[model samples]
Target: MNGDDELSLLSWMYGHDHDDPVPAPRLGQGYVELSGGPLDGSLLDVTSWTEDEIATGAVLMTVLGQTGPDGQARYAARPGDPGRWDWSGDAV
Candidate 1:
């Protein structure tokens, strides 16, 4: 009927019972961060992406300063940094 009880009920409804506190989510687990260029400091969700797909990298769209109206900017993942993607220049 109180906070803990309510949380437990919610957890049960979600199909998981956690006696221990759930650890905070980290980057690359459910999402990856974008670094450098136009898409700097952005987070891309990878929850549904396969390992191969992620490793091959992604072409993310952005409307940052470089990309004007109706424009598209693309970024790619750099080597040795799976947790982050770097800008690869603007797209047509």
Candidate 2:
């Protein structure tokens, strides 16, 4: 494999330089509109969402921009460090 091929494989094996798909947002009951960040202009019609989905999303989004209980930013400064990735995908 070439250098690019090896890099692509490594990226896929880990989270680095990856873009995992978030669930496709859809309409349901109540609605939410994301006004900023990568989700800018995204709308959530929570009506169709399962309670578990909403709960999971709620907890995940809440910590993305907030300090932890100890007050450190959710992400680190040189966050590209492999150990810094939140593999569990839990923020709080």
Candidate 3:
């Protein structure tokens, strides 16, 4: 694999959860809209989203090790290396 591929895998295996809080905004049918601030506190402009979109994003993030407690996967930072990753919770 290329360097980018390796780095992508590494990030997937050792990425942190999205640090920003999800803003609880009013949403219309099939779409949630953010009035102020970036969506998910991200700098990018994310104007709208749907429940299915959110669920799919969460699932993908979990698979990529960027999930928090709410996500399906559980993770903890390594002792010495903050970037390293491992599962932290009860088995099964």
Best by TM-score: 1
**Candidate 2 structure, TM-score to reference:** 0.27
Model 2 CA lDDT for position 67: 48
- Writing each residue's lDDT as its tens digit, candidate 3 over 1-92 gives 89843443333111323553432222331221111211221121123545344433321123322344434443333355432333443222
Clashing pairs in 2: 28-47, 28-48, 29-47
Model 2: worst 10 consecutive residues (lDDT sum): 70-79
Compared with the true structure, the alpha-carbon lDDT of candidate 2 equals: 0.34
Among residues 3 or more apart in sequence or in different chains, the pairs in candidate 3 whose N, CA or C atoms overlap within 3 Å are none
- Each candidate: RMSD to true structure? 11.8, 14.3, 15.7
Q: Using TM-score as the measure, what is the rank order of every candidate, best first?
A: 1, 2, 3
Provide the lDDT at 59 for model 1. Answer: 58
Q: Give per-residue CA lDDT, model 1, range 6-63, as digits (tens).
A: 4333321111133536433333456556666665655566778899898877655444
In the range 1-92, model 2's lDDT, one tens digit per residue, is: 79843432333121112354633332233544333332333333456667555444432233244443322222211133322222232343
Q: Which stretches of candidate 3 lie over 4 Å from their true place?
A: 1-5, 9-71, 90-92
Instruction: List ranges where model 1 is wrong by over 4 Å.
Output: 1-29
Cα deviation at 29, candidate 2, in Å, is 3.1
Candidate 3 yields a Cα-based lDDT of 0.30
Q: Give the per-residue Cα lDDT of candidate 3 at 11.
A: 30
